[model samples]
Target: MSKNSTLILEVKNLAKKFGDYVAVDGISFDIKESEILGFLGPNGAGKSTTINCILGLIKPEVGTIRIFGKDLFKKRSEIMQEVNYCSAESNLPWSLTVNECLRAYSALYAVKNASTKIDELLERFEIAEFKNKRMRNLSFGQRARASLCKALLNDPKLLLLDEPMASMDPDVVDRGIKLLLKIQKETGMSVLYTSHNMWEIEQVASKVVFVNHGKVMAQGTALELTRQEVQLEAKEPDLREVFIQLSRKAPEMEEK
Candidate 1:
């Protein structure tokens, strides 16, 4: 969050191309230790492609990804022990119960005392009642919580989430947000949070990056994004206003 904080992740000159289409165009950013970085963009705005590159799910034609100041591709085995990813779109096996899913992931991360950790997460997420429920049968909110629980199993140094509170009720959303903030404060874990919800992003992220048409439109805190407008109009502007203004522009328009 602080400009002086240690950089935990760096994406330098990252570019991903899908045949002739350039999905990501030489984007670069840094996530500081214990910082919550909100990655926001319109649909088809290259957010997914950039995230895929960061997670090592896809290789970019250009640029390097460094985690903990080490090359991610070269040190993947060692670095991944401290990194975990979660998304509402990725599903666990339908046959696996909530407990089973947690158990499976814990084993993957080689967590010790996994059963005890799973119990603690189940209670923390308030999903203990559904711990034995199959993934296929769980409601969207239930599955979302389960995914988050799994991400925490390793006590990772970095957590990557896409639409983390998707389909959650108000109460659950509040609790989940609180828990994320608590984890950031206590463990000093860095977070890369992608969400379509600007309000949610403002509530959680210390800084945000907005991408449009395969390039970075803006990167700064909510206040900084709206600062110019507020200064010009002598009124406060919310992040959504700035987001829309930036995301809808042509590159030439941006120059002007």
Candidate 2:
């Protein structure tokens, strides 16, 4: 999509706290239509906290969130219909089969032709063989793929994914990335993808946002961020090197 594409999501100066500790501090970012914005941060940099605020699952103490140009707080119910989230930490019913879990979500999302959609997602994730397998019986990678299928059941206009490929084998991860790219191209869907896999982000994201200590430390295309000598000290200017440098260097600022 063009840089002029409509903004699918906008978060401005978001902040959140847990009593004595700050979880999110003055974070801001936006996602444009059909764009994949990769959110990069260290373990405690509040990436997940920011995502929760965007999903309306957690209220921020300060700041505004808008999705599709509408106030997320005021139009949460309506806005959520067009948004979906998937994460490695999320879980489906342990006793239910993959097919059963997906069928239930399709109904919840009020998806039409649910059967066909479910089958297609299963095939896309290469998990059709495990459709009838119970969630507890599947491996971590398999379960993660199943959760991803659930996220797409509604064909959400905005998708939030956190470490969705964390445990997948390289081959499956590649296929999953390709499938997401294909879907995004065909549907103009926007994705807020958070992952530690710098290589994966470099492959799929057009823009990357780096956050440390709940603040946006930097953002740009992968090449731009890597090329910035002050922002990254990588000899080769690679994304993985950039991540390591930022994590080490940015954390010191968190305490100041």
Quantify all predictions' global Cα lDDT against the true fold. Answer: 0.85, 0.89
Per-residue lDDT of model 1, residues 118-229, tens digit only: 9998898999999999999999998999999999999999999988887888888888899889877888899999887777887899888888877887888788888852
What's the TM for model 1?
Answer: 0.94
Q: How many steric overlaps are in each model, in order?
A: 0, 0
All-Cα superposition RMSD per candidate: 2.4, 2.2
- The segments of candidate 1 whose C-alpha lies over 4 angstroms from its true place after superposition are 2-4, 229-237, 252-256
Colliding pairs, model 2: none
After superposition, candidate 2 runs with Cα above 4 Å error:
230-237, 251-256
* Model 2: residue 243 alpha-carbon error in angstroms: 1.1
How high a TM-score does candidate 2 get?
0.94
